[model samples]
Target: MDFVSELAVARYEKIGEIVGKCVEKIEKPRTFSDVIDTVVTDKYVGIPIFLSLMWAVFQFGYSISVPFSDAIDVFFAWCAGIASRIENPYLASFLSDGFFGGWGFVLVFLPPIAFVFIALTILEQTGYLPRAAFVVDRAMTRVGLQGKSFIPMLLGFGCNVPAIMATRTIDDEADRKITIMVNPLMSCSARLPVYVLFAGAFFKESAGAVITLMYVLGIILAAVMATLFRKFIFGGSPSPLLMELPPYEVPTIKSALMSSWLRIQIFLKKAATILFIGAVIMWFLATHPWDATNGGELIENSYASMIGHAVEPIISPLGLDWTAGVALVGGFLAKEIVIGTLAMIYGVGEEGVADVITQHFTPASALALMTITLIYVPCLATLGVVRQELGSWKWTGLVLAYELILAYIVALIVYAVASVVML
Candidate 1:
């Protein structure tokens, strides 16, 4: 063996001997963690176990959260009914249809999102999240990413802004950049509302499996893109996976609640500020160009329609009309807004959004839009963090340019394939 290789082997032997000397078993011969880890961290079973766990998470998450979502929907409907009874038409429309209708659509998603965060927090606090990283580290290594990069990628499932920021923990510049570049493919919870809306509308029986497929597709795409980037954009060998795994423990209720609350707070804050502003602006655009004859037909005569029509031709191949085009434009600001924009455009409010969507979109088109949504450039907030982390607008622009092109290509491919099978 080479001199450096021999030294590394000697150091590992020394460390193992030291650990063996210091540690001893107490009462239980082999602890509970040891038995669980044998199966969970097994090279063969680990990945499949992780996937099965994720499927169950989504299934339980959506199934249990539906009643709470419906409760929020009923509350909004009551508010809309009260506003509709108001004497003044203009004020009533603005309050009921514009303000409540717009923002409430995003708010109703809180149940499922909270459930996801709670589950993720429990996994994280129990220390299984790191094992998940370890389980996938080998797969990541094959794509030229250090196993350390897996943490940031995992964080991306919650939100990409912090995920990109989390890239700072990665020591290698190329590895960090690649991780940041692909983090958006992790499918943040904000996108879940869109998936649920459409999945419920079209694929009612298999909504959980469909959503799981999208998550899986995101992972597959991230790996493929990482491979391409490593082969062409940047060439580097991955660092070896070397990290201590924590023993599993029953997570404290307080710790799990705190973690979940922190994530939910971010969502609530965005809903109040950024999402509220975007909704108001969209409402105005869909209501303006004041005239008497076409006063009530909000979207058809408004400025938003103009913009949507202009972009319609570009996205028409995916079976998107002007309304869908406009929603896509707003989705650039925040993915959660995509469903809200659609709801607003249809004048259906939150409760009737799925029905309206079905009237407008074919199964193929809906699938295509969902695919695009999954792969598109992350919301504007993520771009700012990307620029800050990369320290260059050049890289930020490259990230945007490539994601757009890639999204379009992937969406078209989905449309083509789905069309063939359905036909």
Candidate 2:
């Protein structure tokens, strides 16, 4: 430790010794939190326990959200039915199928999104998240990131824009930059819809496990990439893990709800703005050629399809079809738009979206697509922030180019490995 840190620790230890001597209990008993922490922060089992807890969170989210999703699907279908009976085909299609169908499909994922945030809030409120960070700090240090980076990386689970902003708390320039660069690999919640959709469709029996694996895969890739960055791009040793662990307390219901609501509000806002607009644009493209026959016909020959086809050969080796290509293109605006774009492209309402995805993607291809979505270039907002934070278009462009290349390479490897394993 540095001289300053060593002195600081010594002082805290001395104070702790005095406090222990000053406090006495009639009955010496460890608190419930202490017992839980003993196992939760254990060196041997902490990471596995943390991972298992996350798996359970996803499992709960999927199971509980399904009913709500169905309700949304039925409501949207009814709206489409009403639109179909309208005399003005253009206005009807625009309102019912274009606006509602496109955006509503994306909204169907709100339940699971909210559920994920709620679970996260509970963990944060209970003070387990910081412990999880502490548990993983050793592994992170080996990858050129200290425990401080874990907070920003965990924030990336909600969104990358704010997560990048959160890196400002790191005092060291190299640590902050490295943390920002790797933040995208944390599997933001926006990508959860994509994972849930594909996992439910292809790996139904183990959908939660599959989604958990996607998050775990993101962490692994982030660590590997951080190690590479440390070796090649930025030559610096990681800072020591130094942070205070807050006392575990029973989280109040109001606090958990407020936390979950705050995070989920971001998703709702994006669905209303970015995803909403992207849905309309996609719907128009899919319905274009300005012909009545094409309005409700197959989207295979539409302009969007052409764009996807143009990029097909580039991503085809990864087992992603034209639709997946187009979705990735739309993903540039926001990751959630990938789900909405697929909804528009398939012309399947939210209810049938999973079945359509199942028909189009095999287990190997689905895994590849999820990995690519997790690691590909940041969203438009995140990109702007990166440029702003780095103060150089040159560095921002480098970050973008490197991420795209890394995404493709990782995705292809995943496809190849998944294919072999499935065989």
Candidate 3:
């Protein structure tokens, strides 16, 4: 709350006190909810508490989700092995490498996605999400955004599609436009697999910290960009935040889990449809010309290699190779496909991805790769939403161009700084 809001609150409290002197009333003890609100929304500790909880959420989700994800990875490999053993070679490749390999690779990360949603559900169901917005409200307005903008940015942590849609709550057109533009920078759950893959491969013991860094970086970048947009594009102070904080409620385990699953269904459906098609297309590009390439035995001669090589020069300055370029291309469609693309190229799903991935990137380049993934072009779905919501392809194109430029510049800086530090 700002000075005005605090003053308004004080005035109302004084009025209540005066009324209490004229009428008989019972004094009730402060409730548990009151105690929680006091500590959580405290002036000094509120922001720190919010940051701590965010770090804990990512760490908690990553640590507990490993076994479940590993189990799924193993199951898919078993099915792929069965498919690979068929008598006819082409059919076997199509089934083994095309469908199962494509979809199964992405599915392995489903557990982590669900776990993240579960964590978010706990915070939201308990009404801490609102308080979180409250805790950050002053800082938000300071950056030329309001508390309502924070809610959509918070939702962006789960998915940008819904996050962009959530901006409908912001009544100011300028505020809503700025939020939509910056929302894609929020590091959606779709990017989680990329973070997990790179962090596990390079950072290992500090994977949780690396993951946490990405989320924090996303928020920082979003705020900075929002400020820039407001100063130049929108040219107006943010509307004051006015929202009622709901009472806290303990979320039931069953309800939390159910709601979490509901949120992940969108991911599941995308994996079934868009990602599966992407997988098949990715498989074909990398495995064609059966006799010439000897059935994916010589991937260098495959079409996928040609595409990767074409994009290599553009990304090479960042210490990345052609394969990373190709994966990033897949990323433009859906962030999860970045992982799936790598899985297909290596012929190893998540279970075996770590070993292969480490060979491609040193810790320096790995950080750069993750940074680029964090800020580069929004996915196809997100771009469509931007065009529809903003009702302008011109603005949509600007979002694409600016993000691409910013991502490259930031990624280069990260690579250069990391390289020097490691020395």
Q: Evaluate residue 170 in candidate 1 and report its C-alpha lDDT on the 0 to 100 scale.
A: 89
| lDDT per residue (tens digit) for residues 1-423 in model 1 | 999999999999999999899988578688788899999999888999999988877787788899999999999878987897788777777778778876688789999988888888888888888888889988999988889988888888889988889989888899989998888888998889988889889899999888888889899999999988888998978778788888888999898889899999999999998888888777777777745314436568788889899999999999889998889899999998888888878888798898989999988898999998999889999989999998999989988988899889999999999889877
TM-score of 2: 0.91
**Rank order (by TM-score, best first):** 3, 1, 2
Better of 1 and 3 by lDDT: 3
- Candidate 2, residue 177: CA error in Å? 0.3
lDDT by residue (tens digit), candidate 3, 1-423:
999999999999999999989988779888877889999999999999999999988988899999998888888888888999999988888888887787677888898888889999998999999999988999999888988998899999999999999999999999999999999999999899999889988888999999999889888888899899999998989999888988889999999989998889989998898888888888888787777668876778878888899999999999999989888998888888888787677767556788888888889999999999999998999999999999998889989998999999999998999999987
Candidate 2 residue 418 C-alpha distance from true site, Å: 1.5
Per-model TM against the reference? 0.92, 0.91, 0.93
lDDT values for all models: 0.87, 0.86, 0.89
Over 4 Å off in model 3, which ranges? 1-29
| lDDT (Cα, 0-100) at 374 in candidate 3 | 99
Instruction: Output the number of the lDDT-best candidate.
Output: 3
lDDT value, candidate 2, whole model: 0.86
State the displacement of the C-alpha of residue 98, model 3, in Å, after optimal TM-score superposition. 1.5
Most TM-score-accurate candidate: 3
